[model samples]
Target: MGNNFKMIAKTLFGFEELLAKELRNLGAGNVKEGVRNVAFEGDLGFMYKANLCLRTAIKIIKPIQSFPVRNENDLYRKIYHMDWFEYLSVDTTFAIDATVKSDNFSHSLYVSQKTKDAIVDKFRDTDGKRPNVDVKHPDLRINVHIHKETCNVSLDSSGSSLHHRGYRISTNIAPINEVLAAGLLLLSGWDGQCDFLDPMCGSGTMLTEAAMIACNIPANINRKGFAFEKWTDFDEALYEKIIAASLKKTREFHHMIIGMDKAPSAIRKAQENIDNANLTDYITLKRANFFKTTKETEGPLHMVFNPPYGERLDRSDLDSDFDVEEFYANIGDTLKQEYPGTNAWFITSNLHALKFVGLRPSRKIKVFNSHLESRLVKYEMYEGSKKAKFQKS
Candidate 1:
């Protein structure tokens, strides 16, 4: 408890609450939610555990300093004055990623360059040598964020994005981001309680994440490394102990996890990824068109998927006279007629196509896939007419 320090976990839009709840469950203190980010308090071992176990975090940052900056010079001065030796040695390499939302700092790239120069110059003056900047694989990654007149400098504890879970050796054309998939599953209330399905399971990301969550597996168990491993004060034994403890919490999952894709290539890729995650025992993959299939499970089903948005995989391409409107309508029809007692959710950037589905979404969450703003919509299908309320309200 005495070794607690502040950390911020960055996430995609609309996932702040999910990330905050995850932090609290992980035994973090001072948990607070912000826009697309969550702040919390934990010790060094907890930091390692967070990096390894957090499913929705893109990166974890440990803020070292915060101050008001009027201009670029103030930024450089404040950054240069920090105790750089505490985080990095002259022999180590580092990188700076800067974001500017203030009128005083216009170009983020230029600010990063300036900050790098200040740190290198300070180190050179004191130690006669400076750490090299390695943007690709740095020993220490620093983040500088300036909003309005306030500036916060933090050390990025997760060098690469946590989504590079290392298990995905193969991917299809429209492979979903792992963080996005995990967040979507969490948002859909998927706890391995019932059978799970991702009908359009490109690369099998959703299926793998679902299995991991069901079994209480650490999110990054397949990941090779984390930035904290390169820190000056990294404790290898502590990390090993944390891993053992996390693994000990793993539970047995009785429900089935399945994925289906119309394309055989996608099925192969998904299988390879699932095998890589060592989740082959928990998940089953098949090649079938989702629109033509009926629910195979007997109990309530939880379905989450990302269908073609027509921007990339155009349904119109398959049939020149294809009515995308009718296709989405068929999707709604199939879910209503074939899959009863199910909670179906999907994401798409095309809001117009969404209306053609004919079923009112019970929940619409605004999120992004890369740069495109999209909605994660849910449609609940009841077992009988008496329970099947048509309207979202």
Candidate 2:
């Protein structure tokens, strides 16, 4: 407990609760939820474990300092007064990312510039030479977040986004982000209890994530590196122990995980990615038009996917009056006729097309795919002779 420190895990919108729950399950102390972020207490090893295991977190930040500032000069002075030597040396490379919501600070770039200047000047005064800024790849990445008049300075422990799980060497046109895919699968109540399917699987991201979750595999077990690996205090032995312990917890998954895509290229890419994740034994990828396919498994099925949104992709070949609406309607029809006793969920940016799905969504969650605002909607297909209730368009 003495080694415990506060850390914040940043996530996409509507995933705060999910992240908090994950932190709690991971044995974090004093877990709390915030807007698009979660706060928790853990030691340095736990930090490494969180980065390696968390499915939803985009990045993990360790707060170094917090203060009140009304202007840019104050911000610079407070930042300069901190002992930056603890994190960076004169030979180390660093970068600053700033986010401002204060009435006095309008530009985040300007704030970052001011903070950088303060750090460099402070280092130059003491050590003769100062650390240079390396935006693309830095030894130390500093985050300055200003909310109203309060400023929080933190070190970004995850250098690049956690979505780069290192296993996806291939991708389709609109490959789903791994973090978002994993979160969506969890949100849809995927527990490895039933057969899983991603009918329109683009690059097999959902299938790989589902298999990992089902088997209790560490989310980034295949990842080549993490930002913490570059830290001065990085303990390679401790990290190896954590990795071994996590792998020991892996359980057997009885249900099948399957993926289907009409595009040969998509099927190939999905297969390659699944193999890269070392989950080829647990997942099966097929090149079949979802509309023409029926339930291959005998028991209950769980389906999650992301189809074309008609924004960047061409939906013209879907049908004569092809729009997002018509495409979504086809999805609804295919699910109803072929996949009985299934829970189907998909995400789309085109809300107008959502009405065309015909089935009323049992749950709707707001999330963002990069810059596009999207929704993760769910449809329930009951078993037996009873027909599923759907809103007629």
Candidate 3:
């Protein structure tokens, strides 16, 4: 507790609250929400746990210093004076990731160049040598952000974003990111209590994430590694302990997790990925056309998926002879006529095609699928009857 310090977890636009809640659940202190980010206080072990467990966060960064800078020279001087030897040395290879949202600094690349020059010069003056810059795989990844006149320097603890969750080595076209998949399930209020299904499951990302959430498994438990592993102060024993403790906290999931897709290729890929994650026992995969099938699980089925939104309003997942309008309408028909007693949720960027669904969405949330602005919608289907329970307009 005495070693706790402020850390920032960066997330997608609509996931700020979700990330904050996750931090608080993980026992973070002074949790606060920011735009596309959540700030909290935690120690080194908590930092490791957050990186391993957070499903919505893209990166966890530890701020080392902050100051006011008037120009590039000011930035260079301030960054040069920091204790570089504490994190890097003459033999270390580092990279600077710069972001400029300021009227003062026009170019992030220029800022990165100046920061790099200052560090190299400081090292050369002291030891007559400097570390080389490795952009692809760096020993130390420094974050430089300039907003208005304030400059904040941080260390990137999670490399290559938390979305690279080491599972789903096989992916379909534009497969949902692991982080986004987990966020969607969480947003839909899925808690492993009921049977879960991804009707249009692609590459089994949603299925894998759902299984993990259901069983209390860590989000990045399968990740190859994090940037913190390369830091000079990394503690292997402590990290092992954190992992062991997290695994021990995992609860048993008795409910079923199912994944279905029309494409046999998709089913094969999903199964392979699921097996890779050691979740084969927890998830069931099959090749079935969702529109042609009815719910097999009894009692309180939960569904979350992303239907085809078409490629830039051009090619869609439907057959060339089939129309996109009919594709979306079928999704509505299946939910209203077949999947009763379920909370059906899906995301799509095609707002115009959504009108063809006919049924009114119980909830519509604004979110982003990659860069495209989209909506995550919910439609409730009660158990009494098909047409009567699922309200159709």
Best by TM-score: 3
Measured with C-alpha atoms, the lDDT of residue 144 in candidate 2 is 96
Local error of candidate 3 at 46, Å? 0.6
Higher-scoring candidate on TM-score, 1 or 3: 3
For each candidate, give its TM-score against the true structure.
0.95, 0.95, 0.97
For residues 325-365, could you state the per-residue lDDT of candidate 2 as single tens digits?
56778888888788888999998888888887777788999
How much lDDT does each candidate structure score? 0.90, 0.90, 0.92
lDDT of 3 by residue, 43-138 (tens): 999999999999999999999999999999899999989999999999999999999999889999999999999999999999999999999999
Q: Model 2, stretches more than 4 Å misplaced?
A: 312-321, 388-393
Please give the lDDT score for candidate 1.
0.90
Which residue pairs in candidate 3 have backbone atoms (N, alpha carbon, C) closer than 3 angstroms, thus clashing? none
In the range 222-308, model 1's lDDT, one tens digit per residue, is: 999999899999999999999999999999999889899988988998899999999999999999988899989988899999875
> Between the candidate structures 1 and 2, which one is better when assessed by lDDT?
1
TM-score of 1: 0.95
Model 1 residue 141 CA deviation in Å: 0.6
Backbone clashes (count) for model 3: 0
Compared with the true structure, model 2 gives a TM-score of 0.95
Span of ten consecutive residues with least summed lDDT in model 3? 308-317
**Residue pairs in candidate 1 whose N, alpha carbon or C atoms collide under 3 angstroms:** none
| Every model: Cα RMSD to truth | 2.1, 1.9, 1.4
How far out, in Å, is residue 296 in model 1?
1.3
